[model samples]
Each structure stands twice: as structure tokens, then as C-alpha cells.
Target: MANTFQLEILASDRPFYVGAAEQLVFPTVDGLMGILPGHESMVTIVSPGELKYLVDGEWHYAAISEGFAEVRRDYVLVLGDAIELPEEIDAKRAAEAAERAKERLLHKQSIMQYYHSQAALNRAMNRLKISKRHNHEI
Candidate 1:
């Protein structure tokens, strides 16, 4: 059996997920990172992306925005500005958001608005991508 560790996910208000897992995969600012039990202690910035892990013989996925994780002594904790389950994503809403972002990008009256719109589009796309993949994994 694989070694297990206490895995916790925290957003602004409170803990979002708490459970035991053998491994975790989260999107770091630099790239994706993997964590295993008893792994080296470290902290890194996480991007607006998916976090995947195995727990209780099942895989789980969480979408997060601007977070970081801490690893130490068989425990891994993630603190993010926001987090959500894959199912919580509304496809239609995301699609509409993407469309709006694209429109804003095309009719850009301000540089800041244009770049921010681009980022929003990218984030919406990521959520859609992850949510779709999750349906297939089940």
C-alpha cells in the first residue's frame, strides 16, 4: 500500500478539502508539480489551474486561483484565493464569459482592459478544459 498523508486545501474563508492521499498534482506558477508522501518540504506559487490527487482509491480534482502549497512531515496544505470542484463549473456560463472576453479583446479601448480580458479568457478556457476532461475520467 502506498503511504498516505494528510492533504488539506484552504481557500479564503476556510478549508475546502481535507483528506488522505498518496500523491498530489497542482499547477504551479512555473508549471505543474507533483507531491508524494514524505517529499521534501517546500513552498511555491500556484496558478489558476487544476489540482489532481488520489484519495480513498479515487481521483479528485479541484480548480484553484492564485494559491500556494506547503509540504512538510507527511502533510500537504494548499491555501488559495479561491477553489472549486470540477462539477461546480458551469459550462454555459464559462462559454459566455469566454465570448465576452474575446469581444473585449477585439474592441479594446484600453491596454489594461485588453490584457485583463485575455487573462479572463484564458482562465475560462482552462476551467472548460479541466471540466471536460473530468467528465471523461469518470
Candidate 2:
């Protein structure tokens, strides 16, 4: 049998997801990072991107916004600003949001505002991208 360990994804509001995984991937502020059992302990900031994991030989995906993640020997914990499982994303809604974000940028939003909107657009696009791969109806 393969080694199994607990994985958890949390949002500031609450615990978002908890399960078992053999490997996990998340977008870190520095870049994308992958975690596995016996990974070195560390903490890092997360960026807007897809979080992927392998559970019982099946792959799972989530769209995560900015936050933090911690890795330890037996578990990987993600605390995201926002998180959405593939099944929870609506492609049409995301596309609309992306368009709105582009408009916001074009209208000369502040730097912070631009980053925020850009992050939103990235999150929505990532959600739509990952969700579609799972045979989800767009």
C-alpha cells in the first residue's frame, strides 16, 4: 500500500478542505511548489493559481487565491484567501469576471486595485481551466 497523509486547505473564514493525499501542488508567492510525505517543514505565501493533489491515485484540483501554506512531515496545510474546487466553479461566471477585471484595469485602477483585479481574473481563469479538465460542463 502507498503511504498516505492528511492534507488540509483553509481559508481565513474557515477550514476549506481536509483529506488524504500522496502529493500536493500549490502556487506559492515565489512560484509553484510541490509537497510530498516527509517534505521538509516550511511556510510560504501563496499566489493565485491551481492547487493539485493526488489522493488514492486520483488527481484533484482547486483554484486558490493569495494566502499561506505550511508543510510538515505528515501533512500539508494551505490557508488561502479564496479556494474553489473544480466542481464549484462556473466557467461562464468566471469568464464574465475576467472581462470585468480587464475593464477595471483599462479604467486605470490603482496599483493595488489592479493587482487585486488581476488576481481575481487569474483565479477565475485558473478555475475554469482546471475545472474543464475534469469533464465538468462549462
lDDT of 1: 0.85
Instruction: Predict model 2's lDDT versus the native.
Output: 0.83
lDDT of each: 0.85, 0.83
**Across residues 100-122, which tens digit of lDDT does each residue of candidate 2 receive?**
87788787768999888877778
Residue-pair clashes per candidate: 0, 0
Model 1 misplaced regions, further than 4 Å: 136-138
Off by over 4 Å in 2: none
Every model: Cα RMSD to truth = 2.3, 1.9
Best by TM-score: 1
For model 2 the TM-score comes to 0.86
lDDT for 100 in candidate 1 is 89
The sequence of per-residue lDDT tens digits that candidate 1 reaches over residues 113-133 is 877998899888877887787
In candidate 2, position 100 carries an lDDT of 86
